[model samples]
Target chain A: MEELLAEVVNVLVVIVEACGAAVIIIGAVWAFARFAWVGFRQRTTAAFVPVRLTLGRFLALGLEFQLASDVLRTAVAPSWEELGQLAAVAAIRTALNYFLSKEIAEERRQVAAEQDHHEVTSTDHRGSGV
Target chain B: MSAVAEVTRLAALGTGLAAVVAGALALVVTRRPLPALAVLLDLLLAAGLLRLAGDPDWQGIVTAAAIVALRHLIGVGLRAGGRAWTGPRPPAASAQEKSAL
Candidate 1:
């Protein structure tokens, strides 16, 4: 029974890790395409902001999957060495994930502020013109 | 090494290459080095994270850590430099002044 359980876990770990890799690949390809299109069409520094935000979102998602796999690895039986390695990897990933999410929030706030400013300025212009 | 690890490494390499291309394109089109640099750093971080998908050894862990550190350093530097590029004339202005020059 123990061997059977370990086998199932090993298979699950592989599947989860593959899913995480796939997410990263898809995200990278999508972001690259958007980057090229936006850079070509808009050609402004501000325009690339959305693309960066999207990429960050994808990366954060992928990291979550990877972190899950890390946890699953230690579920069956974790030696001291394995646990130590897991701790290191998990810490690094957690830190990256936190920073990415924070940056995304900040970027969203900035974009919103800019849009609000634009709307107010346009309103003021129209009001003064009359 | 397992097949999954091999595939993940290859994917990471491809992602890194895509990052370089995207970064160069942004640099060329936007004509702003700072934004381009930020894009490059961000994509490289993605690549680094992707590399950690499989069973990463100590070396792989260290490499990813280094990338995270570098990204943080560069990100702080860019933020300090200001949110936007400060020095150069806007591209539109440069284009208009091209005839005068």
Candidate 2:
């Protein structure tokens, strides 16, 4: 029975890891496709705002999946080596996620500021009737 | 082979395949040089997972770290490029002379 339980747990771990990889793949593909379409349609410099925002979000999601998979890999009886590796992987992934999120927030603020500037300029132009 | 080990191998293979596909898609999507960095990260993560599955792939982790560093370097270069591209260009000497006249 214990052997059977181990097998079950191993299977679960594999499934979780597979799911995490799938999530990262899907997120990256989706963000890339969206960015491509936007870039093709609008060749303006402003097009980068949406591209950056979308890519940033996808990257954060992918990093989360990678982190989850790392955690799951150690769910079973982890050796000291495995534990050490997990610690390193987890730290790297967490740091990447943190910085990506911070950049995303900064990009969001820039986008908002640009929109506000555009609105004010339009309002001023309209008020002057030119 | 033990069932656990077999499952881990399969999982690693699946992850590698997914990462390759994701990387290809990212590369295809953008003309800018930015997406390549993300693609490299995806590939690195996939390689790292495979290494974790008892594969003798110590170099994968090192390569991933190098790729991350390269991504940072590229990001800095891109930022500089963007600033140069957008910054005001000085008026041509002819235009300046005409204005002066």
Candidate with maximal DockQ? 1
Candidate 1: where are CA atoms >4 Å away? B83-101
Model 2 lDDT per residue over B1-101, tens place: 54434554565555556555545554555545454444444444434433333322335455555655565566557657766876666679558888899
DockQ of 1: 0.60
Candidates' interface RMSDs, in order?
Answer: 1.0, 5.8
A32-114 per-residue lDDT for model 1 (tens digits): 99999998888898989998998889888988888888888888755887787788899998998898898899889978988
Grade the docking of candidate 1.
medium
Model 2: how far residue A73 lies from native, Å: 2.6
Per-candidate DockQ vs. reference: 0.60, 0.13
How much is A75 displaced in model 2, in angstroms?
2.8
Worst 10 residues of 1 chain A by lDDT: A76-85
Model 1 lDDT at residue A100: 86
Judge candidate 2 against the unseen true structure and give its global Cα lDDT, from 0 to 1: 0.58
